[model samples]
Target: MILPCFLFTSLFMVKLSQRAWNNVIIVSMLALIMLFNLSSNFLNDDSDAPAFSTLIPQGLLISTIEFSNAKVERVGQGWRIESKLSVSKDLQGLLDVWQSVEVSPFEENLQWGDSQPKVTVWFIGQAEPIEYYFLILADKTLVKLGQQTYQLVNVNYQTLIPTE
Candidate 1:
């Protein structure tokens, strides 16, 4: 402990040249900059966050999806649509859109209209069906699941719901 103290005092006693002191300052500044950058890289990491959020949970096999007027079901390897209203021209394509659609969380609270359509979805092995409500506006399509609402990233209301 005495030797360490002596060495520490000797280091300060020996006067460094002005150029050497400048070099030391530059090196210390570079080290501080490197440390700051490394800390920022670790602090701002977002690897856990997904790039895009899906409307449905990943790998969830939907057994039945009931729209406002139509009910679509999975039969064997294909899908069956039973409806009293107008059916989509490509029912499979519509199913694909629902299955693969991505959504982002709505930032602001919106006052939804009274004429919102309800969509009920039942997954395999799930006892309770998930209910979703749609607030289709002139420009955007919003889906409310439970209390949170999300905006459909790519699909519009007309594509999912067809009318004559």
Candidate 2:
């Protein structure tokens, strides 16, 4: 729509005055270039999205965290967040965020089934003894849990829990 309009307007201007044709063409070309550049910039900006992280004191007791050997399974309708960890007191207030939370002498894997329609787990926050899972959408929109929002930052993935 816009391309055609630009071309038409430039052509009409050129038809009105041969002397002004070159100037109109230049202006029209510049306008089209600017429009393309702006649109591409906006599209690229949304590609990776964002995740959040915060620093806390060491030795703050947190449960163990791990991802399933399987890639994050988007089964049924939503993506699953599966992991095993030791239960900790710090997680008491955040239990609602997990699809499943369990403790066992042996590794007990848990899953947050069907997270697709609403959220995508993008980042996981971890400290000396605590671990957290951050979920977001493909567009980098932070997934909200309780009252907190997540954002992505540069961090060590080996130390932090994995996102599929």
lDDT of each: 0.81, 0.39
Instruction: Kindly provide the TM-score of model 1 when superposed on the true structure, using C-alpha atoms.
Output: 0.64
Compute the lDDT of residue 127 as modeled in candidate 2: 29
104-161 in candidate 2: lDDT tens per residue?
A: 1212233333452232232234422323334433533232333343433333222233
Least well predicted 10-residue stretch by lDDT in candidate 2 = 99-108
Q: Each model's TM-score, in the order given?
A: 0.64, 0.25
Question: Which ranges of candidate 1 are over 4 A from the true structure?
Answer: 1-52, 86-88, 162-164
Candidate 1: worst-modelled 10 consecutive residues by lDDT: 155-164
lDDT of 1 by residue, 1-164 (tens): 69857865775788999997788679869978999999999999989884448877787788998887788889988888888876646767777888888899887898876579988999998999888889888888999887888999899867776344
lDDT top scorer: 1
